[model samples]
Target chain A: MQSIDHHFLDDYACRNALRGIDTRIKLILGLGAILIAISADTPYAPLFIAIILSIVTVFCAEIPARLYLTLLLIPASFALMSVIVILFLTGGGVPILTIPLPWLTFTATDVAALNAFLILSRAIGGTCGLLFIALTTPMIELFSILRSLRLPDEFIDLAMLLYRSIFVIIGEAVAIYNAQVMRNGYSSFRKGIIAISMLSSSLFIRAWDRGEELMTAMDLRCYDGKFEILEPKASLTIYHILPVFLFLSLAGILAFLPLPFPPL
Target chain B: MHIMEGFLPSPWWQIWVVLSAPFVIMGFYALRRMVRENREALPLLAVAGAFVFVLSSLKLPSVTGSCSHPTGTGLGSVLFGPFIASVLALIVLVYQALFLAHGGISTLGANIFSMGIAGPVVAYAIFIAGKKVGINEIVTIFFAAACANIVTYVVTSFQLALAFPAEVGGFMASFMTFGAIFAITQIPLAIIEGLVIALVFKYIVQLKPEILIRIGVITQERAERLREGWA
Candidate 1:
């Protein structure tokens, strides 16, 4: 039997403390913070949002700190690589440091360092904002929110079907892969290519078959060409809405204020 | 080739969002029409979208001995036309952003534009041109897949250049810098993806030529020829 954790973030979203909070509020806070963070000039606001939102996710939402950090490492790695490049390649203001290499000399400028820092902080803040939504609000709630927002019913229905199919197809792909590995299907470069292609093709056939079954089932049920969305049980309360509003406003206000510290 | 969240700051992200919206809107209409024409197409399209997501998540062995994920958009565009492929890619990108933390919500517009719209459009165009010119089916599939993968990265590089031009050399130099970084990892992966997708196309032709024919991916004559050659 698969544990609840088998579904990864979805499991957490279903069980989190903030899960009962209205999704619209969560979305607003998350997206509002993201917009503020990305558009902010200094690193302070984004860095603040990053640190605060992370604490909320880990403590308030009760997400595992280790898992959260590990998930964060994905975007962090990309940010680090790009920031290093920007630090060395982007030139402005006073020269900060110069290192000589065999092929080329690298120089870091004050402006470049600041720019890189700003970008890195923004990336962190934005990721935290996104993860907050991912961890606290399940995709089902999001779909309902989209529905309420008056998105096309057909599009929502299709999105729901696609979402459901992803897990089924992933399970099939995984089982096939394990079987392939057991049979030494990926021993060599050529063999590996063939194995992967075979895996993909078989998976494609499985999806096609699954699609047909779904259609038949829907038809049997007198398919109305629309899916009924389970309205999110969470109700709008001042308790939920107020905090998000206050937090976003705080982040927004902080975004415009100048930092007290001197320039690098 | 996902640009990390908040990587595109200010006007750049907004610009990409604006530019990508039109294509996505068109894709949405195309999707609705496809489903309306034949209700059965709805579930198949959904599953096809899921297939694209799963295909991208798989690790492929590259020439450099390192493993990477294929974009999977080329095969999608070939199987479903570019318009529907764009919608599928959009859904996949959203899922990846939410579940995998591999991409950011803020940059979804840019990512959708690159991996979803531009790549599929190019792939479909290449496949059509290849067929029109009577290119070898296998070779055409390879190039279509490979070029789609490469073009996604190239467009990403272009977005980066536009966002952060180098101080000395401006857009051209920044583009070269980003392009070089992408080409190093991406070119090899693209080649591997091309080869794998070509093989997958071959397998599909042999096993389920009817599906391809139904989808208008290949004519009955070509499917017959492919089946015979493979057999």
Candidate 2:
């Protein structure tokens, strides 16, 4: 239950100074950074991109540095784990290190090491780009942008309902979990499993019932097939455009650098 | 079973996004049709998506004395079928990526394919097979959920291997290594997920058989038979 609140990042984004920036601009630039990081062959490009993204997210976006680092580390751990596999299982062109295990001899080659480094940098760099957007932009802004793109009404409505229901269902879940704990429902591992199962089923039923009630309420309010909401217009000024342009050019230059790195 | 953000190289990630697009479009069409036909299904589907989000995000104590999260897609697939489950899973993945930083936008296509498409397809297949075989309902639910969870990881391993194959032994070798590493954590977690889903299914069977019947999970006659058997 405690971890549930930790997952809500949009609230943080809304409080940041960058909240006023155009969501569309952030979307384009953020996605551009991700693409550049992924397309870059050398580790230098991604590493540089990651550094720039981190700096912008922390300083310009005003997201706490500690929180930003923690976010980066989440993907970094996964990248490291897979990178380790790539380093050890891959072998060729003069072994850099060799270790004899009980079952198999593990060897790390120069080529594999470079490959692992490339993957690690790219993954981390891509993650940073995503984090920058996520920490600066709210979900409502993204949905509005999606609406402007003329996505189908039903899809947008469903997304809106689903987004609202997340918090409601999580609240219900916490209440149910608390009641279960009071009854010592999770005293043992087996009991914990059973308790969780019961909690989930209960949540399903409650959600279903709430959905029914919601439908009835909407019908009473003369609900049609579409759920309508006003979209906020984001002002695109030079101030907003300049930073994105500068960031992209820097990223592009880093990506096109003539570094002696293995090709992907 | 998610491929962390930007884990895949450019071509591989883009390819997955392209591959997943058709399924998403099909799912959207199905959802629109269902909503148009039965207006009541709109809210139900929304709640189902939210349930998936919350259920998967819950941190539960595992048998290993550590904590793990459930995929929750299998149960959704059982109730709503694969297409709608794909939509729900995609939404959940997007939310996790943006909000929790648990996954990445660049990897959304890969995550959706693995968790949404592959997992639900496997779960639905198993559910249909179980119904055909007249297997015990609880056992069927267990297998469906567990198998779906494992298949997601299996597909993810294949994806990673394809992207970063070993220098010497190639794709199969890399696949085996990634698969084995994931299995250490994923296999047991999948089993636990199965048990949890089965228990939830049992609870629903007892309390709201009509919901299952409405969703075509079981016919009214089958529900009656299940009730009688339990009684």
Candidate 3:
């Protein structure tokens, strides 16, 4: 929809302040926050996690606040829609709000309200955690970490190849799509289907050609089964590790705390 | 339809990861064997994975005025075997989660299970069955792709229902509610996906029948007949 700005996330990741930190630490912190937020029974901890992670991603990571919020809006909107459905359709305890319609009645019970809040907060927390990682660590850095984690070499190698070729394939696809649009190939639904199928088939052919070229190129280089991936040189500093531990423990403790006020 | 980031609470997500592990492992073994037998399969699989990613990025014009993208797993499954398709789907999905932020790492397992494993396996099965039953190739491809999309959404709905069962009528009612809502948009999208993939198959049949035969999708005799018919 946005003309496929391929470098949007990677641009921030390359430029972020936390880019200097060890990627493994960043991943652990971000993923741990998400796990804790989701597993928590109450909504308070997740909501708190969302706010804290957003602040870190914006202020500390030095990501542009406007761009970060724009990305956050995508998931937030989806969560809001699901929350609305959850609020009205589910029923338990006393009803908090009711609307009488001609064909049917809608009710939002207290239990449903709380459940909706939990879902909304979990979504927010999870999205923030995910964004924090995406904004800080580029995928190139993650490959070595995957290697260190003892993941199979073949799996990692394939991931690397997939990563490298995805951009080229996507560029070819975008070029074809633009050409199709110029010709009014998508003027009607039927035409759109035809245009897309042509696009997909042609892209597949292009990918096949590229794959053959890659294999030939690699073979020319001696056809070794190993791909040499350099590990990032960032050391594990206590300054980064201390803050992550503190923040996660703080969130973990917060999960067990009672809500400051009871919902009506 | 990805289950969104952090949508499935605790045990459900973990369970999906466990359920999906075996298939992914099998995919790895298949991939390893392919490479050991012929190193060319490695780059082909990677590029195919990238193709699936780009396909997901394309917007489909739907009758409901809501645009959705083709999953492309159906095409991948039909072109490559289901096992390799799972590996390709896993790669595409991880990239989608990390780079695009369309899905989440926490829920990656669940998404992979539905889109990567379940959808592709079903699509491959249908494709094979249709061939066995001597059905028309276009009709078979259409149903293979369409049913793949439908089964993906059904599995997603089942996962969500298990996580958030209804207080009034429990898991069954919650599943029906989710299935109904997903059906509203997904049914039309599925039909479109089916048509698009079928058309892609037709183009491949016209241009690269040899590749189809190589992949065991079409027999040599069938390709010869189709080429004669076209000429």
Model 2: how far is A126 from its true place, Å? Answer: 0.9
Q: Ranking by lDDT, best first?
A: 2, 1, 3
| Per-residue lDDT of candidate 2, residues A1-264 (tens digit) | 553544578878888888887888988888999988988888877888889889888998888899887777766556766888989977667799989999988899898888788888888888888898889999887887778889778888888899888888988998998899999998898998999989999999999999999999989999898877776767999988997898888888878888677654
Best by lDDT: 2
Model 1 misplacement above 4 A? A1-7, A101-103, A260-264, B63-67
What is the DockQ ranking, best to worst?
2, 3, 1
Poorest 10 consecutive residues by lDDT, candidate 3 chain A: A1-10
Fnat per model, in the order given?
Answer: 0.71, 0.82, 0.65
**What's candidate 1's DockQ score?**
0.63
Reference-based lDDT, residue A106, model 3: 73
DockQ-based class of model 2: medium
- Residues B111-220 of candidate 1: C-alpha lDDT, one tens digit per residue: 99899989999999999999999997889999999999999999998998898888888889888888887687799999998999999989888888888898888899
Cα lDDT, all candidates: 0.85, 0.86, 0.84
Give the total clashing residue pairs for model 1: 0
- Deviation from native of the Cα of residue A20 in model 1, angstroms: 1.0
Show where candidate 2 strays beyond 4 Å. A1-6, A262-264, B64-67
List model 1 lDDT by residue over A130-197, tens digit each: 89888988999999888888977778888899989988988888788888888998888888889989
Predictions in order: chain A TM-score: 0.92, 0.92, 0.92
